[model samples]
Target: MPLNEEEAVLLGAAWQRLAGGGPEAAAVGAELLDRWNEPHRRYHTLLHLWETLRAVDVLQGEAADADGVRYAVWFHDAVYEGRPGRDEEESAELAARLLELVGEEPARIGEVVRLVGVTATHRPEEWDADGKVVSDADLSVLAGPTDEYLAYTAAIRAEYRHIPDRVFRAGRSRVLRSLLDGPHVFHTAFGRAHWEARARVNMLAELDRLASSAPLDLPPP
Candidate 1:
């Protein structure tokens, strides 16, 4: 699908936030692709960004934001690894810098930063708009059908490069099971109403595959 108007504004805002405005398409496109190329970071790649941006659109449905959700997307996985607080801290820092450069209100920028943190690890009992949406966007991939989900898993495995397959499998199975057995894969009505069944089904199939140990049947790494 083509970039929707709200998505465009959000993209423009991220570009403006990042480079202080008036950035050419080539530059931003290159930056987006560059970020995509970082090995093993594929789960949070530009495609994921594009997909989540679209998912958020599906959720919000043509609303423009005084929101920092756009900004949150840009920084949500900014530091997925190595930096424990990168998503929150760097996202906040980027928001602050963007606000300073783009002339947004300092107070709004702070809230945007706070919103980003709220999304870090969603806690159901403590839900808010940003937290809910951010969490939904991040989990949207699970809602995808088979091939895409496998591709996502491969990308995630790539991210943890040093870990051996045996070790990785053990860890991967645990996480997959956690999602499969969870109460809900997505929190919001829009997503739950739409993507939940598909996600759970896919997750269970993958889990079953992981639980098997027939030497002749297990696929090669």
Candidate 2:
């Protein structure tokens, strides 16, 4: 879906802040927005980008380089294709190229690339403030209200509609199990305090549903 006027304004302001307000920067932002709106996407759409950005704003003070975190958020899923590791690697590469196009410093571009890579595992070192913030913000959807969380899972199912229900359930259940087995679902202190428990509850409930005999009420592909 095309960005609404409010989303456009907000994203434009954010792009200006991070990329220093140039035509090249604007072009790059437009390109990323286009990718986010691609028809193949269901969950990883512009709406997800907007939500991540908003979550970042809530945890901005926790970032060592807040602008870098924002840049990472913009590019983290810029090339999502349902392939987790390769998608992140390509997205990091995309971030590097576009940030360089907009005359971002080499070091800053490198940081953005690294931050984008961190999203692959969501397992940044405890001392990595920017990584923690980016990971937590990207995952904030997991902690949303019950209805919103169900919608998120349904959208995810839609995205992988090519996979059979049994296969998708097994794979998704494994992913959820790994997350639940982790020390914390969210990395940052704010996330741990505010989002961790709810995210766990949501994931556990989804795991139950996935394991049950009843079919999911997911949107048709």
Candidate 3:
């Protein structure tokens, strides 16, 4: 489903706050909402966009260019197709094109594109405050409560339902293990203090379940 009226109003306000209120900004925001509401998306839907934006708000003070990070959040998964690197790249491209149409400053647009690309790896240099904020916000879903985390995984699996069970399981395991191997699953101090441990627990639990299960037989959402 698309964002509800209140949610749409909030998102429009956010876009206008960054890009300014005008016909171009309105059109760009509407197009992005449509992209988020694309039928093929499962986990990477409007809900994820809203959650990531909220997380950015929580970590806003940590960013040198919080508006840039918010712009990145609006485009990070805008082109998600279950393909990792390519998706981020295309999303960044789309951000650049649309942001230009709305007359966003070139430097800010470049920063937004770079921030969107950071989500592909979820790794930013320790000194990159804006990048760190964007990465943390995009990954906050990993630290969700148990039921929400499981629902996230289910939605993800549903998104990639075309992949064979064994293939998907192996890929998902690698992704989880990489996160677990990191010193901290989240980049910001708030994330480390509040979300890191819970994210680890959630990922570890999912890893264990994936290890023991033959295949996830999830119903359509």
Candidate 4:
């Protein structure tokens, strides 16, 4: 869904803050909107961005660098082209350049870039409280109700329409298995308490469905 008026206002405010509250902020915000609103996007559209920013707001109390986390959330998927590590690498680099253009301090820009890159692994260092906060928020969707989780999976499938079904399912199952095998799917205490159990339940159910599906045929060697 497109953002409501209030959410749009809040997004503008965030951009203004990050871009040093100059006239250039509007231009930067428009550019971001264009990128995220690209027609080919399904799940990583503005709806996801707004949801993530809302999550950041709800969890900022736990962040060591709340502004950095917010900026990271906006830029993390900014360059998403369905290429995992490359998407993150490009997003982080673009975020650093944009923040620098806004005359942000080098340290602050570095922190934002670092936070954006951390989403690639979704594993933050022990001392990276801000990273933990953003990571948990970014993954908060996994904890949603079953219907929403189903919808999310469907949206993801839509995003990767180019991939054949068998290939996509196998790749998706592997990703789910990785999440299931993790010590904790969510890093923060709040995320652990609120999202961990539900995410596991959702993942396990999806994993079972995936496993039960017939395997793709292979040609004789």
Clash counts per candidate, in order, are 0, 0, 0, 0
For each candidate, what is the lDDT? 0.63, 0.92, 0.91, 0.84
For model 3, give the 10-residue run with minimal summed lDDT: 212-221
TM-score of each: 0.72, 0.96, 0.96, 0.92
Model 1: which residue pairs collide?
A: none
lDDT tens digits, residues 86-179, model 1? 6557756655665555565777677667766755554434436656676677788887878878777666766665666677678778777766
Name model 3 segments beyond 4 Å from true: 1-4
What C-alpha root-mean-square deviation, in Å, does candidate 4 show against the real structure? 4.8
Best by lDDT: 2
What pairs collide in candidate 3? none
Task: Please give the range of 10 consecutive residues that has the lowest summed lDDT in model 2.
Answer: 1-10
Which is superior by TM-score, 3 or 4?
3
RMSD in angstroms between candidate 1 and the native structure over all alpha carbons = 5.3
Q: What is the model-wide C-alpha lDDT for candidate 1?
A: 0.63
Off by over 4 Å in 2: 1-4
Q: Using lDDT, rank the candidates from best to worst.
A: 2, 3, 4, 1
What's the ranking of the predictions by TM-score, best on top? 2, 3, 4, 1
